[model samples]
Target: MTGRRGPTLLSLGLNRARDTVTAQTPVTDLDEQTARDELARLAKVLGGANAAYHTSDDPVISDADYDALKRRNSEIEAQFPGLKRKDSPSEQVGATPSEGFSKVTHAVPMLSLANAFDDTDVVEFDGRIRKYLGLDGAAALSYTAEPKIDGLSLSLRYEKGELVQAATRGDGTVGENVTANARTIHNVPQSLNGAPDVLEVRGEVYMSHPDFEALNARQAEAGQKQFANPRNAAAGSLRQLDATITRARPLEFFAYAWGALSEPLAETQMGAIERLNALGFQTNPLTIICDSPEAMVAHYRDIEQQRASLGYDIDGVVYKVNDLGLQGRLGFRSTTPRWAIAHKFPAELAWTRLDSIDIQVGRTGALSPVARLAPVTVGGVVVSNATLHNEDYIAGRDNKGDEIREGKDIRVGDWVQVYRAGDVIPKVADVDLSKRSKDAPVFEMPHSCPQCGSDAVREPGDAVRRCTGGLICPAQAVEKLKHFVSRSAFDIDGLGAKQVEQFYADGWIAEPADIFELRAKYGSGVQQLKNREGWGDKSASNLFDAIDDRRNIPLNRVIFALGIRHVGDAAANLLALHYATWDAFSAAMRTAQEGNPAWNDLLSIDGVGAVMATSLATTFNQAAEIASIDRLVAHLDIQTAARPDTAGSPVAGKTVVFTGTLEKMTRAEAKARAEALGAKVSGSVSAKTDILVAGPGAGSKAKKAVELGIETLDEDAWLELIAPL
Candidate 1:
């Protein structure tokens, strides 16, 4: 074996004796000890390499070295049953499950792709497709080759023209419902132009290079944790609980396929992409129409050579049967479409030394451990750090308390396996135990906050360690300030990350109060702000106008604009409705913080918890902060809440469900129109539903309407119902 041996003999759980040497040199020559050692070594190597590639946008290892190690790890696991670890590199999928988003079941399944590892695989795939279509070799067959976006796969459902739902590819059967979050993405149209009456378009939502860079820069400046790669950033952005938050994140969508459509698309794959583009959907621009698989291979080579120049991440090229009819004939097998195959670009891997481990605190106060590595590149990005996740992750320990790889430790200067997939954060997939330095030191998390030296306490039953410094901490303060000026917050124009940092550094603006005061010193005191290199007279006026325009912001915007921890847009809206005004809300928070009689009442709110209440109270308690708010109010106008229109309404508070395809208006328009007429638009049809607006090809919702005995209206009837009054 080329790696360290496992620990002293332990019970194998089977009826095997101690020192039980295999009579035939083991069924698989790689024993459990050897497998564990090799697996760990490979993981460390891959993990470190991935971190370098993503964080720095520079690659270190060649594609071949990474693939060989990955394949070897897979082989070893197959040969050694006892050595497989839960956190083993071989078991990792793409990224961790996104947080803060409600899980949704996809209406149409998002299928996985079949792979084409070599020319032979491509030829065999073509042969199978032709065989299924009963076509001879002489018959001309074409394929569409597109860059396989190695990012999260999602389906956007639209009725009429309005987007209603977005789902992840959860097991290909169901996925998380991230409709609100998906709507926030600018590239993801809320209402499509000339869209199909009903369409479920499948796309790979990714982060562009520019956006990813901006996001990371902001993270670094704020001293908050940064994503390892663009894919991770996109995934995290898309999975936010608040659609507003997701919307604020720089997310882009590229349509790749269709899920469920009311009407047939084009005759060929290329035609479908064109049709998608015409419908105002952002289709992958790299799609090429090829005469044969050879042409596809050529295109793949060209793409591989141009990979560095591409703005978005790509793992390989996907070759699909061009003819729609032929694709149908080819059908599907298991989780993949038989008519299509993804010819993956060779894996990008590299070698780097693990320098140290650092702990990062998230917005929610959960502490996460990250590995600092010698800067290197595995893919296109330069990765200096990789996620260690938690203490359990670092110890090579499993759920059962069994020491993984015989208690092998990941230490400083250890060569590690680094893997990257699209925008997913790079992770330490394995450790190269064979190359472990004798002088390498075991890694340990700090006992105190790395930034503020506050006691980092691990909450009971939690995996993360959090700083006790609260608002006073520099990292937290900077991040909170940034969040306050975010799009979902005050949304002040010209107060982007760079501008905010510049103003903060110059002491021109320390808090929100300083923003309103800028106009007060418009001429001399703040002359530099106007004459700043990027801030000309026109730009300065625009910034001031934007700020002035939002002076009298809505209650919900005010609440969210405060940047309270864990208080997202939805929570802010709920709080606004409960309190109705700033004074009442501030009083309530004070009472809750002081543990007064109203404290329980505060917690009684649906989503309010101890942490949220504490955060709210802490924010309101600061005199300077409160004074800043007063100053802001002096120059601002507060808008009153809009009253719901209910006069002479036919369906006031009536539960209505919409189904099928509508021709005249987009589903969003229809829903808004219905809501305006005092009806509540719901996703599913229930007994409580009074009316079901059925379009032309109504699906399950219509069926449910019949079962529930709800009155149904077709597209024309729905238009008639709302047209009169």
Candidate 2:
């Protein structure tokens, strides 16, 4: 049958016979037509699975099977081009790159919910809803009160019952295409069980409590950095470049709203939620139907009381108008909805003793005082310390000149109110005078640095004191080294926090210069590194290679890695663009300290304030610090500055913004290629923008560019402009 028919039969998971009508016919025999039919069926099933994996956070098929089936379908399509279908899995890009998260004009604008701060606000919301619907005060409205999840907002698009696109809520109008990462989430459905032909569902992508704990445990065990909170963890995980990595992490999703849809359900909003639930999507169970704003406020109180008990993280309760018709009438603001409001829960608070006041030296030598509190759990994490901010914050009193917390001062043995602001860091909200002991000593700012005992003084008009000892300060040195090798900083592979600490403890490294000299001192000549526990020949070699690979670093990255005070990535990039070379930057810093106008100009750069400028100047002014930097420079090879291509380059060094749909390549791809060729890509078109790459359906960005008189190019014209260069 194989020779008589063709490869189609053989490729359809069937055994073939050499001769045509044989006595022993294959039991799994499939004719040409049957094979084609079966192949299409299999493709559809696999595609559905792929969509499930991508659209819904949960996956039903194994990775091995998915890969094999995809490969088989590819082979079939290659052999039978005419048989190829429009929705072939082979044609789809498996994952979207995270770089350059361009704006996606939402089919239906994603509006934010109005916020209700208190019970009064809730009552007002209820009155407005009833007034709009022409309902009597006595008319009760059913409401579904649910915990408002604190996580990343996403929109999933489905076409013909299959998931097509998933996007982040970037600036409302645009968002990063995180479809691949979103697929890894188990709760996000790849294909609806009984989905509509076209549907767009909005959901909150979160990391559950148990999953968050396990993730943090793994992070701790692996010695990798841990997330500050679950919301941050979920956001960071969903934005990962590799979707498979996202799949490995614990992520959850709950459908809360809808965008563009082809059909309508019952008149009420609750009916639409029920429909979503029937479609196998996970919706928050806490949702309640309330008839009036008074009932909504009651529901908010109930949810707030159960906030700690709920396994998932929720910042507040979302109250939406039940009737769809009324909702349409209510309308919306620029970025938020008018028909709904978010009722926030009261802040979590705890009382603890102020054991002591200690100063911590940061990487920038800023001495920040911390209130050492008795161990207490304010939100979830244990609170042992709270930021005192500065001397003024500690000394200032109420308008009456009495102590703020009932005449109590921040001192040892004084009870302090520890409050978790937005579930982040615990801060000393107030001091309790009634509980303050007679022996409670008044706290005073330290005269010397806690780490190095260098003269610590508060500068004029500055609230916080700073350590003058730059490189000699132990705390600052350790933090600076850690920051230099952090993932977002230099990204020096194999040189994580543990390794840095180990190297520092071993007396092998004291400054950044010592890192580049590790291979020279411990390479083939020494066996110490290999003999050390957890270190092997292969690991050592890999580490050495990773270290070597980072020798030629980008100027912007190098600037960031220097651990300069208040100099983040954006500031570093700005500095690199302005200076263009390390020597130029160094010279500028020195001249700035010497009162040069150019130095003052550097200080005048946006986001670079007088304090940051002073710190930068102070860092380079000392001869010892300069000598140490020179030594570090001697041990490392400075990367050559990339010269902007001036020959036939119309867009080189020009700032460009892209908007709408492109025909030749994806917006992400275009932006990446343009950046590689030495063009700056800005999210918004401003006066500094030189060119605007407008595609079909260009929106406000293009309009702004035109208004500013910036040159504009269409998709084809953009391709043409870059083609000559």
Candidate 3:
């Protein structure tokens, strides 16, 4: 949420244009307080939209509505710059990376592009660029026009002609490490020739129309869920935790950009793209240099006419300054490059009848309402469902409880207009009151969980209602068990979702602990798994062997496999790396639950916040949960987190502490830098602390370091010491 930050690039370019604000008052007419409040609301809405689109690939709002709100935010900010929030949306690019994969911080931020909605906007964009460069009408300028592929963005890093890492565009700065999955893509090269010594190739990962259809056919044949669109399928495939799953998916890449280059590929954008093509990379054939704004728009129109025949999804055409030197001079805004703009196509709309509304509970017990609609074609795909977002959305309210759709609420048996432009999920755009049934009642969200019948509560500042059933809820339990054996967790080779569901139903396994006792309980009884309808002697043996194979697991895997809410793989790794051993982590959690300083220690681990700290404490405090964990631990040998190699790093494996206000950098940046250099960043100074970096206003921590005779360095000294890294 912009909270205090303000609006970001996602607010400007991610979606299509639509009127989201119902208030009649214009931005210029609003008072300062009203404007501030509106800005905050826009920030929250845009932030959530960004996360849903970038992190989950499930957007909750229509692209049009998102665009409208973003424009309004910009207007308000422009009229009142001093009222901008601390966490402005304008400062953010994408949501934080998901926890399923390792995090990779990009050498250069992958900024988003500003958008041009119409010919007027396009002309304005060109004028702005020319004006910024102080160019007159006589000075010739060139720009590149290419399809804006509606798929996931990827950055492939190469070192010395060898592919080193692949990452998604996560929050612009840090991304998910998808090297293994990227390697499985047919077009992603393992090695490159005539490439720079170090290069970060940026492109889109997409699925062709034919491949998407074929994959959907296979999914239907296998009784698996089909993808909503090619873009979604491509994104889901690329982000798969298992490389084998990614390998099975038909995905392709088109190189369009570069980051962190050792040497210039070419002086111009088109030339660079051609160079990429020569280096055995897929480049968009339609990309061309347009000498004028008229040429650019003409090319865009040509691409739009051929969009249906392209055999791939493209939501719009991207226009960029062709000259690399011009791009360098143009530079960037807060979260977008000033040298480029995306000219989006109009949104596709279709009318559908709302048949019914269904409630689905996620692993965390968030009750999501899905609108089941009569089969209708949206764009080219047949649509049967759309996301209702939350109860507020059904009641025609935005995240800030402001009226939307002219205060028109959604009801069953209503004729709804669905819209899908570039988003993976179709959104209910507007309701046709003329065709709505009079008897159709306004929908009411349930106060209890539909699955567990537990008390469902929506905490303050939270939009979704969550069930309080915890582990007792069957939906949560089953989902947790499935997640426990997921690719990043226990990863039992032969035990999958089907096996987990079957075992749970048969009373063979109720919890993760029961998984370890499988062979002991049913190895030679009448209840043996081999006697089951789908199991043979060999299959049953393999299942048991798979479970046994995971008896010795890494500490991080053990923590993540626990499926504690808010504790994802990345968070679990941080905890593991901090505590080193399972016993130490467990003991610390217990102490933290008892209101000891361990609670503060948990909070001090950089990314671990109070909410996450509370979740960890709550999980460890429960007797039932502790008992289950104890049983699970008894059957497994959890290894300690390995110390990183200290070959080139002086601070590797060392515990460092920072105290007081940092003048040179923010605390978060300082902590991140230390952690990146293989040093453990502790929140509090203790006997284990090897070095103390003290800034102005250093207090008790500094005194303690001095009393303990620990090595102490001022901010300047600390910076100088790690300057080599």
Candidate 4:
């Protein structure tokens, strides 16, 4: 990997003797096996880098280089999200706290920020925030854009205007208490004025450029190793065990955020930061209100231009929703706020030669084409594979009728521009047509599934082309099995995606029903799951118990676990309410072919439409599908679906169909009244129909009701029966 041409990925210290077989393999172009291999290496590298920067006051890589490593790791995790290792670097926040400090557990966690590396990401961040708050695209949103300090995050607690505690933002939950070291810093006020009884000020402890250079000069004269950067210097100075030594170091603090407050700070983000500044804390002076992405980006650019002269290091600009009320509504995801994002400057981009194009099947059977590139460095990370969203993305057109890549189609053997940013997968931003060979191949999409040889279909108006093989395809089968035990489905403990995939590969389980018979089939056999690698006796026992716990599943879980098309959790719940039980729903679906009366009954369910009804009918009516359903049902007791509390309503859970004109009540009025009592009002009478109301001029419907042996009532009788409710 490192001859006269110079090293690429192997230069990142990932070089290995065994890795020489395919030393050119790009980090981004990964199979599960290789991803695991690369993730382990990255974890070790990043952990060491964090320690060297945070604890030792030394660094192996520049801040830009370290960020790129994290970004590359994030990209790999995104590609194989389900295969995330336990020791993945993305899950960690910072290095371990230095010894000799008392640990403090924060009541409210100090979370991290998700990053947006380019203008497109900034626009997307705004859109995602609006979507979460149920705001329209045209809605006016105010945001506060501030410089993101490249320093250690610290939390300072004040009790009735008196400084009480100080700690680092360690792992977002707990940290080492550095109250003594914090008091030594001049910027950290020992007492506050006009502040709440309890307030926790969260900010960054940093050193300015002049102070950093001065401190390094002093260290050099004292015959001590100089610090690498201001951030490292500030972190090391603040965490020192000796208070006098920390007091001698020149460090500063800027209040940007808070953790806990007894009283209201302000209505908006800008107001709160201003209040903090008024309360004798130094907040970043460049903080400004930006009402739109254009304003935010303008401010970001201004900060980037002035970055060199700011005297402190700043990696990016942080934009947060201004209104506290809106922030509460937007809330948090995992460890980051959805309402806020760190909009960094555009990452490094480089030209790489296109190696080839490969089509891969996703969990949903969508055949996504990937561009395999010749290994090249982009933004300090090795670039190998870039996502070609679909045939159109490869062909340079978006679904919205806009031209991307300047209306150019990417061809094999062409030099392409690869762009990588924080967490986003590296993409072919543009193609270099001048470098394209005259005979470069134009990639064509396959008509059949690559895995199962089934028809691959691109539905009308859909950007993605999907395989139609259903459970027959191994990819679809494994994904469906994974979905069945997903958190929203059966939620069988100890059974995750990895386990499901392994079992499927080993032929231990092929479908949902096969999971229940594991004990009977392999309990005493020579081939047993407990005997497999990465499995133990206790793990096998726990898995079996977990499976047994879900034997009697709720109807909604059952419906969701089936992985039916167009029937999500809400639709499944609606079907569960209307049918009440699996047997009832299955019988109705078996009888519902195309336009049968049972099909109409299924369609009449609230939220159930033609698309969902047709898909459900077709799925349940298939002989193979029904047989599989029957086998799964045989091992357990099927719990009846619970309806919303309607015990007081006399007509609750009743199926009523009205026919002909009513004398007392209008047909619409009668239907509304029955539905209000939780009754399923149908347009046609079927075997499932409980009662049919007949009136004057009733003809075919009345005779059909009688033929079906459904109880019939007159319009007056129907009015009287419903009147009691």
Candidate 5:
């Protein structure tokens, strides 16, 4: 989402469109309020767009534009499945038929196809289909590929081979009776000879580009309003109140699917499409049978290459299971069919002015640069921001310290290309040096933290420049507070990132310790949390109780909640396993501050090294931090970390180090498996190490382990050792 500090290009455009979205989209995942607000706003915008296009045949935005909004709505719904609204756009095909025509409820609901954003998604779709069908590698499977037409979804009902009713796919189940207008279209046959007794052919009603241009020419000559695009033109022409008017317009139809069939049309999807074409209906001629994922992607590319020349619009390529039997087995999931997908073309890119750059601080205190772009449409998504990566990137350097952009640099007022893909943040791809503006200044890294006024420094060999204010920085403090209740941390109920931010903003809480003290400070006074906005007696009480419940937490969680630099979940767990209690860990850290015997013991604990030990010691040395921790510790009983169950596991209670690449699995997978079986996976080899799994590329770690007389095993030997388990 575009930030609200100033008017982003998106906000400016939204204002120009006069559309009032309930709330701006949150930067990342949608919380409860953000989801509700965005959903309501999208519903209003899309519902309005739908009515305008379906009822009047005059759409305000392009087909691609509508798809983007609908796509955003779908994404938000997915992130918060529990917050899905009853009037969700995902459950609908189009707007309700206007009052001009009577409504028709179909026996079978017309559904929409799910979308695939890229090649990986297409491969995943194929793999998912195979997995669901209990199929494996080299198993024979096929799909029918065709252009996903950009037009209104209409269902043409027939009775005993006679055209009886024609309707729009309104909300899937019920639709407007457009029989009079539909009968005027040339491709729609009044009577069929070899069709099902109760056949309902469903497809799109579209107008070719030439026909649309000619229609617009005529409209201009007659002083009538011209449509925005062909889909709108065709939809408006077919949905005319007067049959004579619809008959005069050049509206075309392509029958690709059917509903409410009295009998099976064919055994396969392609055969059914052929049957539809035989019965006096137009079907896309480019439809092909694909036998593999590679073939499907190749077809998608082929169709995308020919999309513009085809005249009418096509947003992407649709893939359907060739075998109707397999399609049945695949079945449906909520709003879309499981056996089919619309692999959309990559989002279109647009050139926009690079307005300025903004700096954002993260939880780790790293200052990241962001490019503020003039709002522009890239694949229907309005992009106003892009990642600048770092100071070097803005100066036209790549990650490998090589120069890109032909030595050209991005600056304010330069025309830059922005690319947007599915749910991906738009990024500046290239700059038009020819359009670069004068007096543009180069971005410089800040010397002091913007959030806490602390000195910011770039550590040796590190690309990111970070603030050294630790938890004293407001930005770092809030982030640490949020992390203290993260999913992998304490995970207190009703205390999410949004709530943490709220608590920080309203002065109700600051540090992790402040959370436990909330009930004591505001339980009964006018400042009671229950009296706060968005809070009630039961909810606030539940929140306080939730806080109390987490008073007895695991040692690993307490260590992680401290947000000590370089101390990740794995490291915290290892420290907990080594010390077994908070008091022991604290005592060791206090002693380790002076580089005593406890310090060497700390460094010798598998992953714990000089850097992490120093950080742990520094944390306890800080008066402010120590006081905060002491207050937090006084409120609760901390449990010992859960050790891996060692029973029946051969690697149990062993210290192991994996050196070099393992042929059987990835390094991450191997380490995870080793830990699961009660083995302490270390990064470095030491005297305490029990064994070393050295692969072909083993380096210094293996040599050190051998020098220390630790047992060593090759990847094959390691696999053989665990083969029985």
Candidate 6:
């Protein structure tokens, strides 16, 4: 219910304050610190969700849940504009392309759409568009309304009226090339007549309900796993490495939009869809032009009513400005277009009894509470478990001691309302206090680890309680080892999560270093791995080979594999690039633990916050962790972080900071361009900063840079300097 877009999506606005807080807190009530923390958590959660949905063709969270969190993040950023994070969700599109497929760079970025949850939100969306276009309430504004297909986005490129290539929208800018598999889709046309010389037709690749059910029946008969949903099935079928397999599956395409065109397709959005339909493409029949917001909302309601009978799944309805000229004038925000919005259907709710509350410790030692529910059908799925978020959630209080759920605590044996909307795991929406028994016990979080009995401590300004046992705890240790071999980490082919658990249970591999020692210890002896129950001689040999392959890993991968608290792949990459080498980074961490200047150095590296730095230092300073890391390093070759090809750029290897309002582009774009040219883009201007790009109303950072005698350049000068490329 708040205004969505800010002037800058990724700019480090005013001074940032940091504190852990829950997403349930109202935007109007949140302080700057809480807003910053909420943004950080949202960024991480959304990043992981995007990767799960796009890269793996599997979603971890439901669409409704994701939208709520994203909307909360946007509202918070709107209130505390200066606290926008560099890794803000508004700056990210889809996930990075997965492996196995060749990469393709989209000619035009495939951005996502903002969501309108309710009728009021939709009305506000229309109001925002009208206000932006200088139109009053009386001004006529037509929009194209259509079902937002719950399917994978695909772009088909045709040159000279011949189908050339097709790509999946991966991270918006770069995508995965699925040309062969796309050609097998029944609705896809091999050629286009009366089309532009070059055309990039954008649309959704989906599976109809009949097709999906049939495929699942075939899969069950063949002793294979049934698909979770139609969307996943379509994505998996289209991304098949074997085109023959894709041909065997039922997949369809619905052309709805255009990306790049040699000439204009149409003057209006509805006209463009008609033209695409004429050009041998299957456009949605439900797509219509609405003269007003009321008409658009009415169409959305009609579509929602017809959702069950539509054959294909549609999570929401999308409304786009019909006039091409007005759309161009509206332009775009960082990750979404201002001229369009998705009006989503409400989440489905069902009442179920809360069986019990269970605590599960993660790799990072945080204790997560889950609600065990009686089997109930919600949105066509039998959901027996729901996320409780944290202990505060169960206690009906947020991290800031603010009341939530009307200050009603959830209790076991109570009938809870579960809701599911395109979610793999449903959540408890409300507690039925009338159904609760007087003898029902209030759920309480354990002060000790359930797995290892380690002292569970909840720090100030932190939401979740953490086990202090470190690597000693069995749950944390096993999960940490699993993280070490994840796809982005060492990625030992023969050693997956199952294998890691087995090896740990067998007392063969304890830490990451133990993996590299397997060949030397168990290659030829009576205790060989070939003698194991599941592993064969060839499998053992291959496992060793895979371990050997990762002996020489990149610094970023190494840092991520360590699984230090608060240090994810992005943070690891930043640290790796900042330090360049493992020795420099490790030594710096060690020095920083002694309360020296190295602490400031670590803090100065843009994106490395105090909490993350403390975690790094704590990991390095711990004697047990150091020994483990030393052993691991002894068996591996750690490569230095590689720099971009900066051949002649003057700013290459120099630390540059941008401050205040930028006129040329979004702050994210400017930072990306600078990094592409091999310049280090830092958030704060420090003594080590080589240049400061200052715009109007440049604040403390600019003044500090001036006092420090760092080279200062305005927007025009900075652009000119980096223009020659």
**Can you write out model 6's per-residue Cα lDDT over 249-361, one digit (the tens) per residue?**
99999999989999999999999999999998999999999988889999987786566557777777899999999999999988889999988776565566888999988
Better of 4 and 5 by TM-score: 5
Error of 6 at 688 (Å): 16
For model 4, how does the per-residue alpha-carbon lDDT over 678-699 read when each residue is reduced to its tens digit? 8878877788889999753355
- What are the lDDT scores of the predictions, listed in order? 0.69, 0.70, 0.82, 0.78, 0.78, 0.82
User: Between candidates 5 and 6, which one is better according to lDDT?
Assistant: 6
Q: What is the lDDT for 55 in model 6? A: 83
Candidate 4 has which clashing residue pairs, if any? none
Against the true structure, candidate 2 reaches a TM-score of: 0.50
> Comparing 2 and 3 by lDDT, which wins?
3
- After superposition, the stretches of candidate 5 with alpha carbons farther than 4 Å from their true spots are 1-355, 373-385, 398-400, 404-408, 413-429, 432-435, 438-440, 468-472, 525-527, 593-596, 645-648, 653-676, 680-725
lDDT of 5: 0.78
Per-residue C-alpha lDDT of model 3 across residues 1-725, encoded as one tens digit per residue: 10111123334322211222533345666678667766776787788778777787664565555666777778878999999888777777888999999999999998888878899999999899999999987799999999988789999999999999999999999999999999999999999998999999999999997888899999998989897667778888999999999999999999999999999999999999999999989999999889888999999888865665577877779999999999999998889999999997764655668899998887778889999986543543546789998999999999998999999999998888886635457789889798787788889999999998999999999899999997788888888899999998999988899989988887778889999888788655334777888788888788788888899899999999988888997798888988999999999998795356898788888679888998888889999889989999999999989856556888887899987546588677898788778888887888899999986435567778999999999889999998987
For residue 59, give model 3's deviation from the true position in Å.
2.1
For candidate 5, the per-residue lDDT at 318 reads 93
TM-score of 5: 0.51
Model 6 off-target regions past 4 Å? 1-223, 229-345, 348-351, 375-383, 417-427, 524-539, 643-674, 679-724
Q: Write the per-residue lDDT of candidate 1 for residues 1-725, one digit (tens) a residue.
A: 00001111111111111111211123255445545655565566555444333222233343344455555556667777677666665543322233444566555656666667777888888888778778888899999999877556778999998898888765466566878778777778788787778899888888876778888898898888887567667776776666776777888899989988888778889998998888888887789998877888889887765554476677788998899988887777655688888887655443567878877765444568888976543454556788887776678775555776467667877777666543237777677788788877766767677767888888775566777775556665556667777888788887777777777767677667677777776553335666677777678788877777777788778888777767987688668766777767767776664457667777877568888887788877777667766776677666655535768877877888876545577667887787677676777777889999875335456667888788998878777776667
Where model 3 places Cα greater than 4 Å from the true spot, the runs are: 1-24, 349-725
For candidate 1, the per-residue lDDT at 279 reads 82
Pull out the clashing pairs in model 6.
Answer: 13-82, 14-82, 62-423
Cα misplacement distance, residue 4 of candidate 6 (Å): 25
